[model samples]
Target: MYKPRINNKFHKHQIMMEDPCLAEFIPETRLFTNNNLIDLLNKYKKVIVKPSRGSLGKGIVVITELGTEEYELLQLNKQKHINGLENVYKYLKKLENFNIPNIVQYYIPLAKVYDRPMDLRYIAQRTEQDWTITGKYARVAKVGYALTNFEHGSSILTVEDALKSSTIKNFNIKELNEKLNMVTLSITTCLSRYFPNHKIWGCDLCVDEKGSIWIIEVNSSPQIKGFLELESLLPMYQSIVGYKTLNKKKGRRSR
Candidate 1:
């Protein structure tokens, strides 16, 4: 059996930064280190440290500035309060497995619904001629959880429903929807330029309270069933089949 994948955060970030359009949306990310952590904390005041190759939001740490010489670190459902930068670095190092490389990302204050952080997932797939967005939905984190992943008990919401339920005031629904579509397509196009073999992607994105959008990650071989049901995915299924059929025909003609 053959497999295709891109799980390295550094490699993916480097590829994305090459596209000028995407570089702005991606938050500052760096390899985890004692100095990097302290410097990032002093600059952004809050940063997230996570393993480079991890899924379902595992082993992620959210560090926040509490006050002078005091910081709070949140992992999964637990929070640890520590004082001073040296202590913070030592604590994180002891908790992490040194064998696995880790990355630190600027934590975006994502929009929320009912006080719980929420994000969106957009699916794009290759059509006969080009790529098109299939569908999108909002994922709200369970109360007190740090991640909005399905495995973490997140609740799925329609775009309209999420806006309606949120405390955000004076928001333009149409404008938000248009922005999401444009960004999702742009991301699909840019990534496809480098990795042409993959035809489908599950893009994890988020919007801040100021309506600024960010591309959190792009998942190849995403878990489609999270939002796509058997009936809803028929068109996508057909599109993939059509693409493969054309490729097979072309291969035979060349031989």
Candidate 2:
């Protein structure tokens, strides 16, 4: 039975990095240190600084290199243009949530639809037997915003619509689903070995313009409200509800 949700992003990243199959899907991530922040930025040019235990996109800052000695530190839609490394640290430390433990990661250049970035939420759940890919949807960022969580959504589209309309011009939908399913299952199975009680994960993932899939993060306690919004997912939502019930009943008997 699910006991408590896992909310530490860095810890989860370390756990998943142990599996060879899941490593490539994960972006370069590390605990936020002044050195790590600078190193990742220098290597990736564009990096994301986020709270280790944040959600709904709060406390996430996307830093992009605009030119020599010029950087853009974006939080929500407000962009702060800066001119030096000293000022970069100053600007970030001024944010209200600056004290929270944070992580720095190489930001994946996600595929965009209509000039707004988008990513897919892949949900996998388990039963008495094995994990299954149960729900998926494309979350488009609000125009001019960097974060695309439900709180910052422009609209939710079927994965098909997102892939075809976005900059990715070529894909066989059958082949794409197969790859997504295989990767998602591998992730859930690998995670289950460490977090035995968790039975569901909502992973935020994206495909770059080059068509490589990257796992943004794995959510241990994924919500179903977004799945409820899509009519086609009603049955899947019901099954999730049923699974939670079964877990609760089984937990009672064990206790």
Best by lDDT: 2
Number of backbone-clashing residue pairs for each candidate, in the order shown: 0, 0
lDDT of 1 at 27: 90
Q: Quote model 2's TM-score.
A: 0.93
What's each prediction's TM-score? 0.85, 0.93
Poorly placed runs, candidate 2 (over 4 Å): 1-5
Question: Residue 62, candidate 1: how far off, in angstroms?
Answer: 0.5
Collision pairs in model 1: none
- Over 1-255, each residue of candidate 2 has an lDDT whose tens digit, in order, gives 323237888888887788999998999999887788789889999999998887888899999988887999998898989998678977888888788888899999889998989999888877777787777888889988987887766578888888888887577777876888788888888888878877788888888888888989988877667777788767777887787788778878988
Model 1 agreement with the true structure over 98-170: per-residue lDDT tens digits: 4588888899988899899988888887766588786677889899987888888888877678777775557
- Alpha-carbon deviation at 119 in model 1, angstroms: 0.3
Minimum summed lDDT over a 10-residue window in model 1 is located at 224-233
